[model samples]
Target: MTDSPEFKDEESIRRGQEFINEVYRKMSRIAEEFAAGEINRAQFHRLYNRYQRQIMTVSQMIAESDPSGWETAVKSDESTLHIRRQFEAKAIGLSIYDNRTGMPIETIGDFSLDAELIVPMLSSYRQATAEIFQAGVRSTEMENGQWLCFMSGAYTTLIVLFSVEPSSNRIMLLDRMHRDFEIANAEFLEHGYTSADQLAYPFYSFIKRSPLDTQDLETELDE
Candidate 1:
């Protein structure tokens, strides 16, 4: 007898839904356990915070219309961290960084920040945004049958690694993901932090496209 494909199209959709449902169930269980005094308040807070962050991250991925799939990690400063929710058999890891200092507070595992990886990832994000605005096409490449990536925005990028099957629909996925990313980006901008310079590199210098004007925030507040 021949073995079945790792995922049929219908099965893929079903599994995607199942993964999301499982994540929800896990988060709910954590919340219930915390409420029942099985976990301490601090533990509950950490779990809840992680859940919130994961939801935001996952929402971006979903909005970007990713097909290879995505997962999130939420780590804390302490050593007793645990994965409160996992959607797939694939690994999910998190590294918490001090927003003020750009220093890592804690990393769940070996989540190294690679500039070579990040540069292309950021480029993909820019292309995604441009495609959405112009209704153009997008594509992605799989390296050594292992990694797949689709960019959602400047700060958020989705990376999926193949454990079972290699990504074959990367181009189609990238195009569709870009559409979803556009909608998510619009919503993200409405919540503030739209400029890349503002959120990612507040200290970097750039040649302005036009003359810089002093915003109300730039004006000094009267004591």
Candidate 2:
């Protein structure tokens, strides 16, 4: 284990506890199988390796959020359409797709730094979502940091990426974004969109005027 700071704020402590709980949740199941002789050492290592990065990341983030060693990240606006976490300049990116065509209709915010890593994960998520939708799951949350959220409409799918650990405020904002998208595009989508550009243009205006501020989150943390 890496050396971490001795002092952590209440929120940081809570996050650390969450990380520990998640570790137990994942490892306990595999440990049971191994102890019962259901899997060999080779299979055990493979299974553990699959989740290692995410688990380690959660640990690392807990350390970084400790006040004694690292700065607590604050969120800020990167651009008119981009909001970023304090640790890095990367901002949460947004995308809309035609569920039937699987073609991207529009994208807001830059995801270039981690685009290579993000695209394939997004693809896998969408595929899983398609299968699960038949079972009445309209939306599902994935990723250890809650960094990505997926939501689907009648004909459109929405993907949101957070460069930071997502907060309830951020998720609530996304809910509003989804609602506005449906209202703004309902007529065009009902009658069939004319073109991708035409369908996506309205969203630009809506998002620009919408609340993407993270000040509320920062204030909550302060309390």
Candidate 3:
């Protein structure tokens, strides 16, 4: 078996300790995700164990370097734990679908999915939602880690494709945007929304809003 890494200098020890602390921070986030129901128990268990093992391996490396390395890390533990971790999910695409016809009213942004493929999936989702507990929002992560945010309104459904799992704040903004869309186009939607231009596309501006801002839709920047 190979021996653990040894660092003779303070800078190397500091960098190694930083890595260990970074792993700790990741473990902390995983725990938070489990608590917030963002991750299931199994996922949390796997991620937690992986991070834990990584920390162990790295800690051994650093310990074999400077016996005081752990002591140095301990001094800043509280401050490191208190660091706020911000999550940003990139907006990949946005689509508005007519609930009655399962037809897409508008689709824009950088998504690669054809409307043909999405319609059947939306149908299945709607059927399942009708049969099961239908919530205000449905966030799904694909096998490859792409995130889909589905927000339904009275007249239409909003489908947002995201680069990664969005935060609760971003999801809330989407929910608000869907609600606003219904209200903004209430007249046209209630009567008959013949064309995408007939309704005001509130989400049009949101397409440009990437890496999601901390501000909400109501406080959205005017462009």
Highest lDDT among the candidates is held by which one?
3
Per-residue lDDT tens digits for candidate 1, residues 1-223, read 6535544434544655566676577689877875564553445566666665655655555556553354322223222244322211122222222223333333332234474764565466556666677433322444543333333433233333322222223334443543454455545444544444333221111112212344533674432
Q: What pairs collide in candidate 3? A: none
In model 2, pairs of residues that clash are none
Pairs in steric clash, model 1: 64-177
Local error of candidate 1 at residue 38 (angstroms): 1.2
Candidate 3 to truth, TM: 0.60
Looking at candidate 2, the ten consecutive residues that score lowest on lDDT are 76-85
Q: Candidates' lDDT values, in order?
A: 0.42, 0.53, 0.70
Off by over 4 Å in 2: 1-91, 113-123, 130-146, 194-196, 200-223
Q: Which is the better candidate, 1 or 3, if ranked by lDDT?
A: 3
TM-score of each: 0.27, 0.41, 0.60
Instruction: Write the residue-wise lDDT of candidate 2 on 1-223 in tens digits.
Output: 7444443355566765675577567777767866764443444555565446445555665667443222222122122122111322122566776666666776776433255655675577667767776322223333543356666667676776655444344445566666677677778767767365465333343333323346764787899
Instruction: Give the Å shift of residue 13 in candidate 2.
Output: 27
Highest-scoring model, TM-score = 3
lDDT tens digits by residue: candidate 3, 114-211: 76767777877787677776557887888788788887777888899987676676677778888988998898888766487577666666676433
Candidate 1: residue 120 Cα off by (Å): 61
Instruction: Sort the predicted structures by TM-score, highest score first.
Output: 3, 2, 1
